[model samples]
Target chain A: MLNIENLHVSVGDKPILKGINLQVKPGEIHAIMGPNGSGKSTLSHVLSGKSGYTVTQGQVTYEGKDLTEMAPEIRAREGVFLAFQYPVEIPGVSNIYLLKAALNSIRKHQGLSEVDAMDFLTLIKEKVRLLEMDEKFLYRAVNEGFSGGEKKRNEILQMAVLEPKLCILDETDSGLDIDALKVVAEGVNSIRSPERSFVMITHYQRLLDYIKPDFVHVLAHGQIVKSGGPELALELEEKGYSWVENKQAA
Target chain B: MTTQTASRYTAEYSKIETTLPGGSLPWLRALRSDALKQFSGCGFPSLREEEWRYTNVSGIEKNLFEPRLEPSDNQIDKDWLENYRLADCWQIVLVDGYYSAEFSVLAGLPENVTIKSLKESLEAGDGQIEPYLGKAVGIDEHSFVAFNTAWFTDGAYIRIPAKTVLDKPVQLLHVVTDPNRLAATRNLVIAESMAQAQVIETYVGVDQAYLSAAVTEVFVEPNADLTMIKLQCESEKAYHFGGTYVKQARDARFNHHNFAFGSLLARSDIHSDLSHGSECHLNGLYLGVKRQHLDNHTRINHLEPYGISRELYKGVLDGRARGVFQGRVVVAEDAQKTDSEMNNRNLLLSNDAEADTKPQLEIYADDVKCAHGVTVGQLDEKSVFYLQSRCVDEETARNMLTFAFANEMVTKITQKSLHDLVLAEVLKRFPQQGIMQDWL
Candidate 1:
């Protein structure tokens, strides 16, 4: 469903991602594990079409179309979701208001009718229940004064509502506790289908215990140095990232 | 600095002096004459003065707006007037600075409450008028106060009895019709000890280039609670000057909400003084579009110990408009434990739009908590991208953010009808899709 070939990304004068290649077919979950300053965030930002990052050389394709050329909103409407590492706090715009606007925009892009108000409410309430959140959260301002775990669950709830084709989780598990991590993982697992795909970017292997990935890739020094099965995550967690660095250096 | 422009208004004073209210009272006449002398000497406030530096009143000097001698219903538009005359309240309508009895609605008003025209109150020898007049604010405070005292023809006089709780708000609606008409009015609102009441001052006029200057003095007696709201939606081509000065007794509570949405050039001053253990809250929102200029000035004085004050003012300026906010908070030496915070935020939507904000805190008490903040900026780019990622286009996202920025102040109004009315006015200025009133 998505392909990244020789993607070289730079932020201003500094090069962050150098000649990266990754591929994800439909219904696949890929986990990218990295230490500090390993360009994990750079890759997710480039994929989501965030500004301030220049793709010096490379191409990213989604459903056989150029993804990098699309604007952020256009990419969003085209079903490419990026769960931010730190969700923004919008003080005045309510949570339900934004969800409705986003859903309507996506529907309009696909030439579908706007969701009925009653139906929209039902769908949102169901999603809120799935995420085990209070109904009052939908009426409050978007992420304003929300706890870390609540913000992560809010992102997952949004993913459940929008039902995007390709989801990119950028450090979604960093601030979540064990209980919140289970809830978020359950929410993500419930939405898993043959037509959906996910790319999870994390710094620790603890999140992998909740949501197992089909394949694991160890990213270091701006490139993937090792690719293995789920057992590789346990080995890395036991031996530390230095083992991977030593092996790759050898 | 005095200017020669006051000669024009002074020259025409003889024609309307006999027609003004309370001409038969010697005390009133002496007050008017003293104010006229002050106005004649100082003229209108000039830009050289520290307080009037941001605003220039040369426009008033250039035009000679004459006041109507009597209340006239010849050009009154009932349909348009209904837009501002709120329901379920006692209303007092003033047209061209004269009370219009035909358009006022005061049925079922409490017997203890005194609600009538200031002119009628003066004619009936109601001794209550003299003590409150020029009490909260003196004519020497500025030239505008002197001008209003000298030229005001009529206004509403409201007094809620001691220990009385008003069932409904009192609406003082000010309207003007003629193109070059001057509407200068003086109002007095008094809440006796232990009383609670709400008052709303609404300003509207026909589509013309006139002048509307009004001064309202308020007194909240000991332990009384008074909430006042000023909604100024004057004609776009008109000029407006409104000042509300208040005095709070010991343990009194006062709240003022100022919403300025219309007028080509407008200036409003809201000043309050707090006594021992009293509390005061001041909130204001000004939206300027086209070439409109709106200026809001506020001051809070903590005179005794344990007084508290909070002030917040927000402005949205678009096109070539300019919005100004000047806020000052003063704590006296005797006012120990004074808690005060002042904030002014402005949003400039266009390259030509401008916002000038100044916040001053003068504290004499060494042990006091006083803080102030000011910000003049465009929309937050991170917020814009956040909305854009939620599938909102860049333009819509900007509009939504701007509307939300101003709506924060609108939601502070608790009265349903008034909140809806003010919300409609805000929506009319910045119309955005998906901004349903139900959602708010």
Candidate 2:
């Protein structure tokens, strides 16, 4: 479903991701673990086509199409979803309104009709229930004054609604408590299907307990230093990122 | 001492001095003369004056518009007028600065409520007019106020008795029909103690270069409540200057909703003086397109202790349009425990479009709580990207965010019909595509 070859990205003059390579197949879940400032979030941002990033050398291929040339919204229409590490809060735009606009936009991209108000509400009600989110929350502004857990949950809710072909979770478990982590993981698990792919970026191995990944790759200083099955996560958890750094240097 | 426009209006006033309403009354005669003297001395305020710094009135001054004294058979389309006339209310229509009983509908009005033409009331010598007319707005404030006072031939006069609450709102519709026509109308609204009323002042005109100058003085007595809405949708070639001055007694409440969407150049002044324990809320929205220039100036004065005031003004400028918002709140030395907040936000859509907002809070009382904020910028790129990430197109995303910003003020209107009307006007100023008005 996705392929990256020696992806070198930078913000201004500072290199963030240097010679990074990754591959993901359909129905597969890949967990990318790294220490702070190890280009974890930068990978997610570059994948989502956010501005202010200079990809000097590399190509990202998604479904045999050049992903780098697409605008952020075109990537969205092509079923690429990024659960932002830090979601932006828009004061006057309601969650429901945004949901409908987004859904309709993607539908239009695929030559589908716009959803009626009543039908859209009915469609969102099920997802709102799945996330255990209050229906009233749909009427409020987009993540304005929302609690940290609620923001993360809202990102997952968006994922569930959009039903993207590829879902990229960027630090989705960073600030969540134990209960919130479980709920977020539950949301991710419910949406897991053979046709969809998942990329989980995390600082800790705690989220692996729920929604376990098929493979884990340890990222150090922008490159993947170690790759293994789920057992590699346990070893890294026992021996902190310093061990990984020392191993890479040696 | 007077410039061309100022002395021109003064000269026009001299031509019809004997025919102007209240001419027989000595007090009104002296009042008009005094106002004319003040206007002649000051002329049209130049940019040198602090209040008129941003707005230059040379356009209105260059053309000497003659005040229309009679209701001409200008063939006003009834259907066109019906668009502005709200349903189920007593409407007082002023056409070309003349009271038109034909266009006005006063059916089924209550006896306690006094709704009539200002000229008629003055001719009938209605004793209620003397105490409230010119009571709130002084003639020496500016040239526009002085011009409206000295030259206004007719307007609306509504008096609600104590404890009387009208079932429906009152609509004061000012219609301009001729080219080079000036409609100088003055309104006097008096709500006695415990009275409640909602009044709407609407100004619409032909697609011609005309001038509409109006002044309204509202007196909300102790414990009374009054809500006033001003909708200015004049022609693109027209010029407009309107001022609404309010004086609130102890425990009184006043709310103002101002929408400025028209006129080649438009300026609206809303000022209120709050007494002990009184509360005031001023909300305004201005949308400018093309070469339109819209200016909104507001002032709130807290005279006694325990007065509260809240103000919010938002502007959207596109297509080389310029919008200006200047708001000031003053807390007197004796006005302890005064709570006031004022905010002005502007969105400039195009590169050439400009917005200037200045918010001022002057508190002489030590115990008062006052805050003011002003912002002028383009839409947030982060917000735009967020919407786009949700699959919304960049243009649609921008339009949605822009509409949402201006819609805040429209949602403040609780009146359903008025809300829809104002919403339509606001939507008209935008491109009107890709934004789901239904969803909002």
Clashing pairs in 2: none
| Candidate 1 per-residue C-alpha lDDT over A39-137 given as tens digits, one digit per residue, 9 for 90 to 100 | 999998888878899999989999999999998899889998989899988888899989998999999999999999999999999999999999999
What would the per-residue lDDT of candidate 2 be over residues A26-143, giving only the tens digit for each residue? 9899999999999999898888888899999988999999899999899999999999888889888899888887888899999999988788888799998888889988999999
Q: What are the root-mean-square deviations of the candidates from the true structure over C-alphas?
A: 1.8, 1.6
DockQ of predictions, in order shown: 0.69, 0.76
Q: What is the per-residue lDDT of model 1 for residues B21-94, given as tens digits with 9 covering 90 to 100? A: 89888899999999999999999998898888888888887789999888776778889899898888889999
lDDT of 2 by residue, B106-153 (tens): 878998788888998899887778877788989988889988888898
Across all candidates, the chain A TM-score values are 0.98, 0.98
Q: Give the CAPRI class of candidate 2.
A: medium
